[model samples]
Target: MPASAPEAPAPALPRPLIGWRLLALFYDLWPALALWMLASLCFTLGYTIAGHHDPHENIAPLSVLQWALWATCWLLAGLYAVISWRRGGQTLGMRPWRLRVVGADGRPPSWQALCARYAVGTLSLLAAGLGFWWAWIDRDRLAWHDRASGTRMVRNPKP
Candidate 1:
């Protein structure tokens, strides 16, 4: 008799809308806000220590520094998202909200994918958050970044 082949298990269905992803976004927003505030304070203190006669008069330098700090913060946030998403399949935000970022095949996203997502996300926000709003109207409920990176923010299964 010929050897019988084993059957593969059935694949799981994709997640439906649960609103957890939006909650995760809110959770993540707080930390970013705190970081921004701290960065601004540090810049202000450094400016004062430099003996600028009128700190307000150095608007150009301050603006440039502020932008740099903002970029750095955004990079840090991206790192956080990438690491958390790759390792645990969730960000600090996502964890609390029971959301996770995964590829179409249901695996954690790659670093390049994460970076691409963040870059698109930044651009989306720069365009007045229209990308985020896309989730509301998108058929799959995906944000701009999710669509761009071919990723999904799905409701994580409960452990």
Candidate 2:
């Protein structure tokens, strides 16, 4: 045989199993909950101060206002996820699990891509987590959000 160049090393797998990603999501909830609490406190204080009412009164908050609070919490959570992924390709939870999010080109995703992923991921969760569950059966083990955003959650070995 003619002299041939040595074969290049194969790259690491870019897809982690559903459990790790789910664990990451579960771990991420702590921060999101903290943000939501902080935000709700601010909203409550503002509303009470505006109405000149005691903030500690046992009262049912307005439904409309409750919805607004939910929206705010959702927005903050999305920002947290997108920012983390954009800056480092991993969040606090993903770090512990040695997981990373990368674009189809194997680089950090664009802001637009991250936003899309966050949005679709929310939808997936709202729909009983079918989107995340998709990974379990997918031939390539990619979630709906990953497929939609042209991004994938990759698994990395321990350092």
lDDT of 2 by residue, 32-82 (tens): 999999989987888797895688873356766778888999999999999
Candidate 2 Cα deviation (angstroms), residue 157: 1.9
Runs in model 1 lying further than 4 Å from the true structure? 1-13, 16-18, 53-62
Residue 23 lDDT in candidate 2: 97
Q: What would the per-residue lDDT of candidate 1 be over residues 50-95, giving only the tens digit for each residue?
A: 8754666543655777688778788777777778778887777777
RMSD of each: 3.3, 3.0
* TM-score of candidate 1 to 2 decimals: 0.77
